[model samples]
Target: MVPRPTSLLAWLLSTLAAIVLIGAGLPGPAAAAATTTGVKFVDIPGDGVTLKANVVAPAAAGSYPAVVFPSSWGLNDVEYIAQATSMAAAGYVVVSYTPRGWWASGGEIDTAGPADMADLSKVLDWTLANTPADPARLGTAGVSYGAGISLLGAAFDKRIRAVAMLSGWTDLNYSLYSDQTRHLQSAGLLGLAAQLVGHPSAELTTMLGDFTANRNIATVMEWAKVRSPATYLDRINANAPAVMIANAWGDTFFPPNQLADFYGKLTTPKRLELRPGDHAIAELTGILGLPNDVWTSVRGWFDRYLKSDANGTQPGKVYLKPDNAAAETWSSWGAQTTSTKRYGLGAIRWYDGTGLLGGSPTTGWSKSLPNDLDTVANGGVVLLTNGISAFTGLRPTIWLPFVDRNRAGVWAAERPSTALKVRGIPKVHLNLTGTAANGSLVAYLYDLDSLGNAALLTHAPATWLSGTAGSRTLDVSLSAVNYDVPAGHSLTLVVDTVDPLYYDANSAGTITVAGGSYLDLPVK
Candidate 1:
């Protein structure tokens, strides 16, 4: 497990000091054409405390539809004023509220625990009880934190006619821990953010301690499972609400793979949009002087599902814009296996002491790759950008050199015969053995251009919870991706042990890649 910060002061400083778009300015009426609206404060019977909420009604409204907005993590209900007001103007009895524990709301922070979930149910119930909300036309939408609860609400409460989520995680385990490797920075930052915005409940404080200390994953996972909507997806699908999912492919907090997993399982009237941006782009864009394309599309989604009015047209049925910042849409999310491109790992020495990543797919060779202790000892953040690169403008592609030439194995495809669009998850076939008691294997897939500037596609790691301690052959699936490796650009696959993002074996072991070692990609 990645070690957590030891000092309370360090944790406090990080959370309080680090705020993303807390005060980022939202644009003028152009982004929010929802018109001036009437607003009322509402107090409700929460699980064990009083819940504060807002009811923003369209200026000229009579039993209009209703839409509920939940604040993102660490934010109050008012944080979504622009969104609520805009929806209200569009004829929705817009209801928005802070979760308990934040912005002077009652109760302690549970991180979407039982209390939080119950609070959401009661909030919606109270909204209908007090406001002139059309119970049949109720809808919900939010980003990141709010996006998740909206899904949860729809899953348990069928009264929600429509639901839309952006940058929300479907599975907490997948988002927080992968291959037994805890996403340390993200997990830690989340706890700190919660602390900064809302003081912890006694239970939450204890959970935070276990998390920060890397004490035990079992405890953390159990708590996460209760709050994960994917756990209840089957139920959600059975009595599902009209769903719209806008997942940022590059969001580190909510991996696209998990989002796709949720989208695939939803058996309801649904739409999907996959864009490339970090965690907050869908919500923070309007605040940063950028056109609020995403929010505008969201309004149309509610207009259709909540009001039974298409209002002209909606965003794409299924939007996909991966790398290169270009977008395309389809009817639904499905596995697209374009032709296969295979790159074989060989024994040839390419860079420094590293084995070559470049060769014909037919090449078969056994090569001994050592473990890079120094790189394991001192590996920095893999990239400068936190999650996905921005969608607009031309940005520099990432160039990755071997951390330790001899210890890390580098394999590249012989430059593509033509420029090919590579999409979907790449599979790695490996035959390997351990020289020590136990070991781990890490593989990173990258797109290397003619001049050797490389950009990360996706990576997967495997570790032994407990092992045979000797020779083992394995096939590992890297993270699912929709990246395009252009013409003249070759595919680079790096294999080694240990990554800073994951728990490192920190053990010195040699795992030789036997014959039939190759990287298989989906090429279009």
Candidate 2:
């Protein structure tokens, strides 16, 4: 979690004083490099509160376009200083504000609730009234927490004509309670960060408590639905804002699967881009006025919609960057895959306690493992593991010989004759039987080299609460990703009961896996 400020008043005063000095042309190197003229800090009226904000516009601006940026979680109004300055120099009035309950802003943190939506409209009101901004040309953009607010703002306010959401989630339920299991680490990190920097609303506090305790799950799901933008997709389509979504494939907080599903349902002009990095890492440099592909695409998106510049924007295209491969473009998300490959699971072998993966379908053999154990095949640490992989291009790896077959079920495939380009979601189906009434299983897809080293490609988890007496079929869809498997490398599958990334229900039982199981791979 992030550390708290020494004193809220002192921190706020220091930040505002720096902005004032920058406006006066007497600040540090970074501040001096920004657009100096027409920069001012002000307090905008919110929903019965005051919002600390700043405005940057062209010095000789007539009626230029306008953009509003809401700060991310645990950040203040100065979060977008560099991008705001560059947009101001590009003939656009930019207003960046601290959301309520963070830094100097008033009111409790609503967590992108109704109050946050209203606050966004108020920021737009202040922008049109104070700056020389055209009312007809309006846009909103943000990252992570701010990204969710921006998407919801477009649905509430028809004045917003364009939107760019980076590292944001559309389905809150899918993010927190995907496949009927709790995403423990991601939710825990978010709760801690909010408590450190801001005051959570009564509803948010109650929901977090219930979520962690695994009590009143119904109430938790209902509360999350209200905050999810997917619940208001119809309203967004009716308002018809040109939307652009950019996200990283390895984002631990907000995965790309939900965003891809949401992108498929949009009727308005939209674009989707999935790159290789962790949450917000792909756009971090761009926030510093540095050259970045994601930020460049965002600028092009705004130019096309807000300023009607169609020089670089593709309205209905999907862009993807696979690991160790060139970027690819398609007409739509569904067009990325040309075919699907199905593999069968063979009986567990005695040589190395591993089974065949791609032979004919073999049945009548059952393998049982202790349910309350974890194996080496698991998702890495929440933020640090994937964040480091973003720069190193090395994913979490495991050795086949080290995996305890008594705790996990492992399967291996023969070396492929040619390279395989995986472009979409992979799925696994299993016939499971447990001694207790409930259990959980995590399925991992890996790329195995000749030396028995396996690199994790994608994975998913499933939990069952009833009908443990008989065999039950569980279908799980792994995360969406793009990767290339080189020739002579094999594909492997691993099923375990526990992963540190999620909360499992397995305890004091043996989960049995029968035959007639299969895996489906989507290839381009």
Candidate 3:
């Protein structure tokens, strides 16, 4: 039997009381039997301060499985209420708490340090002792920073039986300083904001300074080397099943390829779910302004693994949303959605006096002329060259939005053949050259099949090229798709410096290119 609020007012009051108690530090039972439901607070020992958490458990009196969610920039207890409520209603215990130095919790927050993992372990032990939670049925889940903590917890805590990580980063060093450019949108701005709000530590401020100045990757890599999860990958408990979910199409924060690399390295019974969306979990649900679908998925996964409940559970399932056709419709893996095809590069082409030959040896490529936002608000310029013949069969179109700019190019390719249906993600590789020592790069996939067609693929952050870069190869994996690239239709890769939707471009650098660049299209 699940616990129910006595009444609407009671539930509201209980929630208010919980909030007040968290803020004021007064020690009274902030909840009643009816509205209090199953939530409680427990204290854990920290290095220099005491750590506390707001825990929600199944209403029934029997021992239940538990899942832990660590704190992020805001109040973890409140941010995870939806998940807590859902998991509790589904008869599981959910623990949401602040990390060492955030809000009500005491001690300093060291981002993703060893101290945080130890704190998480202490919380796990506290939960098992104080509640009717089965110690053998523990799991963890979170998103972004919280997800990072969850990964760390699972790596150190053998008691955790499973984990669901959303948009979690694997190598912090690579994420912050890939290609010697700090990602202004994600690691730069968002990370700075989190530090300011959560810890306000001088160390965090200095770190933010290094990121803002576009310092070399080595500096950022040094910080990441001390805090990355890569060093602890082998420590992940093998008994626990892990589900790594990320948006291959996310343009704001992590690079999609890096996430894929992390997913591939997991030693546990792991799975990867790549979707089309930004970092927000709501995109997975298609419910604008509502709770994220990941919450439901988490509950279901916990129910299946922690409680051994077989209802509505399946393993190794991969879903890809159709591109440009319809929103909210997903196709199962192995379903043919795109026609397999390839596009050739090396064909001599010209764009505004820039002659494209087989290699960079063909000179005359210049930096992209800056266009006002209005000129290329939606997409980049489509260069029409006469030297190259029109493509035949299923082909991909390539377009460069930013010229002579570092980290602001969009590469688009034509859609695949209608007959060859595509079920998985589309991959594009390009051999690029630049005159500058450092720059950023991004790739996008567009669906031209629908009215007001939108981009179908946006990848996580990846290394573009840097350091007196000559010709460098860039491989981008887009979000999973099951759609038809109709006959006569084309898939375009928008190559640019930065995704306007996510980050701003480098206003202070010059990036020039030679004509030997070629985009290799692998459609499956």
Number of the top-ranking candidate, with lDDT as the measure: 2
Per-residue CA lDDT of candidate 2, range 75-180, in tens? 7777777777777777788898889988789999988989999999999998888888999999999988889999999999999999999989999999998888
lDDT of 1 by residue, 12-41 (tens): 334422343353224335424445355567
Score residue 454 of candidate 2 by CA lDDT.
92
lDDT of 1 at 516: 62
Q: Is candidate 1 or candidate 3 better by TM-score?
A: 1
Off by over 4 Å in 1: 1-35, 38-42, 211-215, 287-290, 311-316, 350-388, 391-402, 435-438
Question: Which lDDT tens digits does candidate 3 get at residues 145-240?
Answer: 677888777777788888877767777866665544444434433543455445645656567677566455466567666666666777773545
Model 3 stretches astray by more than 4 angstroms: 1-36, 41-43, 237-239, 244-248, 283-292, 323-340, 345-434, 440-444, 448-456, 459-488, 496-516
Candidate 3 whole-model C-alpha lDDT, 0 to 1: 0.52
Candidates ranked by lDDT, best first?
A: 2, 1, 3
Q: lDDT of all predictions, in order shown? A: 0.68, 0.83, 0.52
Show model 2 residue runs off by greater than 4 Å. Answer: 1-39, 467-469
